[model samples]
Target: MPRGPPAIEKPQLEAKKGKKEEPKKQVKKHVKKQVQPEIKPEAAHGESNKDRRKQVQKQTDELFASLDKEFPVNQMGPEPKQGPKTPATPTLMSSSSRPMIRNPPPFNAVVAGTAASNTAPTACRSAPSPPFPQPAPIAPAPAPAAAGQRDDEKRWDEQRWDDKRWDDQRWDDKRWDDKRWDDKRWDNRRWNDQTWKRSRVQDWRWKEEFERKQKEMDEVLAKALAREDAAAKMAQQERLAAEAHACMSQQAAMREEVAAQRAQQERLAAEAHACVSKQAAVQAARCLAWTQQCATVSREHEQQQQQQSDAPKMQQQSKSAPKSAGNWKHKNKPQPKNCHTNPGQNMRDGRRFKEIMQKNESLKAACKEAEGRAAEAEAKNKELQERVAKTAELMKKECKSGKDTLEKLMKQHEECKKELKERIQKLEARKKDLKERISALEAQNAKMKEALTNEQKEAEEQKAVKEKVHRNEDEQKKAAKRQKTEGPAKK
Candidate 1:
């Protein structure tokens, strides 16, 4: 098997955590021993100088041949060695994280070896540090491999000039420059993509969760608003019902009052009419009796005068006087009183009659006024009765119209024209039919839902049965597959 050049194992560094002093001492010691190996004197064995030269020549030839195969002559720099890569994710830190400063390992803690030794840690040639977090800059470990070559140099003094060319640190610097080792160090794009993919899921989940919470809140608010609206509607309905009851009671009271007023007015008018008629009859009777008495007294006085004036003529016409007496009439006072035998009695009676006549006149005037008042009262009472009847009819019509729907009230309003009202009425009828249809449909839907629930239950039972059969089939298939793959004995 082909293998890389063998390397001498160097001393390991013991850098304690949170410590610097101890590692510094160990590193110093390590550097001293590794850089300067002990030189020992050898006994002279008579080996030929030509044989040593031949061996040196052969090693040189092999080194050149290996170099030619690894690199073309055009590429002046050696190809950078690749180490086992670590994922960039391990070095990542959160944005809120503070930069951490740690104590670096002591310089030269690791040992240096030749390019052929694969285990050696490669040193970055550049002094500039990377922007991102990385391992601390490690100083190159000292190389003590030149001990064997040094012995060769001491033994063969002629080889000093050639040995010095290879021994100088400048040659090592040129071979291991910064640019050569920096190629394909880290992939920034891959780290960025991984970070974006990782955070995207969390961002989407948070967004969806926020939206769901908002929807729930909105639904809760909607339900609260609906409850408030329902409560308000209930209160309004109660108020309207109370008002209607009060209005009905008031109307009933008004009807009773109107009937009572009409009855009282009719009774008063009848009483007034009867009283006026009775008074007029009494006045007529008194006036007629007074006129008759006056007429009788005047007739008697005329007869006595005729008899006294002509005693011989009256005795001759006395038989005829009885016949003419029946035709005798007398003029009289408006309201006469009986005259007594004395003139003073006559004057007194006249004065009494005059007072009586004056009283009769006043009574007639009063009767006339009373009749006028009665007529006025009757007219007023008739007007009130008509008014009450009209009011009752108006109230009845209003009560009847009150039972009408909102559409009727809208029809009466001036804002709604006849054409619009007709259209509205037609639409209302259609809406009523639609409502009826919807109610019927809803009833049917409820029945259907019940039936659907039964069907769904049956379907679920069938699905369960089907799933069981499928499970059995799958189990059998799995058993067959298992038996075919692992053999039946394995189970």
Candidate 2:
């Protein structure tokens, strides 16, 4: 690879040295320019000086070319050298070090490369090697023979291997068949063995004891189950009974309600009938009273007509009597002379007196008859007034009774409405209470079911454990019996 430029310490030092020298030279030139005087030279001297200036410029160019060759052209300038200790130029750094222009590695490429490198060692450490060399199998020790014990031990091992093989085969078969395995037959086989019989005899005794205990437990369970069943039945029966009772009560209530309604209806009907009858009676009484009034008015009118007719007749009689009086007056007027000597004059005076007395008696009789008719009419008018007054009094009494009954009916209707509202509220409250009780009972039932499930699981687990222990004891006993039988034969 091409190495980066060798660290140019000398170039940097020269550039720094030039920067210091340039400032000193500038100071010296400024002093010289200040000290030197400006002078006007002749044309010939000016031309000679121009040639001299050209010669000096040529020499200066040669010197500059030599310096340019020795150091770079850029090094000739009085620019400051960059160093670690030096403060960076703000403009140069800002322009050259723009963040946006820099090229960076792609994120995925960098990550993938890093991950490849990082995982290399881990792969080497974790990778499996080719199959390892097998370890030497350990040789089993030769078992010391205890006469016939050797055969028994061999038989026991062979039987154990057979049992293990059978168990493995059975497990595999069950898996292959997709069938459920039952321990019941295994448990029964263990239970039927000779050692298991002795152990079971002991266990049977223990089991008899346990059975006694279990019997007690079963009795207790049965009793508890019976109690629960009885309780459930009783509760069901109670509920049924209660429902029946409620139905009966409802029936009774309905009957009572019907009866009450019928009674109320009858009462209303009776009241309606009574009101109708009262109205009819009142109407009848009013009609009768009106008829009576009309009859009384007709009778009074008839009596007035009769009185008018009699008055007209009396007036005619009075007029006739007055005419006779006028005739008597005219005849008496022409007989005035020799009144004491005439017998005829005395007879005329006697006749005139007799007629005047008769006329006065007739007038008195007519006056008495008119007085009697007026008295009869006055009595009839008074009777009609009494009848009218009695009818008005009866009507007022009937109106007062109707108003009182209407007020009473309004009050009863309001009371009935209030009672019905109260009953509805009570029924709603009872319904809420019953709903709460039902919710509580449901929650209790859920808890009981959970407890029953847990208890059943525990009982099954205990049964499995007991069966395993019984099998182990039977196997041990069979091994012992086999050893004993083989020992005598070996001897």
Q: Which candidate is the best by lDDT?
A: 1
Q: What is the Cα-based lDDT of residue 386 in candidate 2?
A: 64
Tens-digit lDDT track for model 2 on 1-491?
Answer: 11111111111323332322211110001111211132212122123234534564476568657756875645434322211211111111122111111211112232233222221111001111111112223235454666445544454344433333332222222221111111232233434543443553364345436544654575576557656755665565555556556555655555565556556555655655565566556556655655575566456446544655565675676576656655675445453232233446546645654664565455446445544654554455556446545644655555455545545554654555575557557656765775675577557556654654664465465456555644653464355445434533553
Q: For candidate 1, lDDT tens digit of each residue in 87-201?
A: 2112122232211123211111111222112111222111211222223354343334355444432433323223322222222222222112221121223245435534653
Off by more than 4 A, model 2 = 1-371, 479-491
For each candidate in the order shown, give its overall lDDT on alpha carbons. Answer: 0.43, 0.42
Off by over 4 Å in 1: 1-201, 253-257, 287-491
TM-scores for all predictions: 0.34, 0.26
Clashes of each: 0, 2
Q: Measured by TM-score, how close is model 2 to the native structure?
A: 0.26
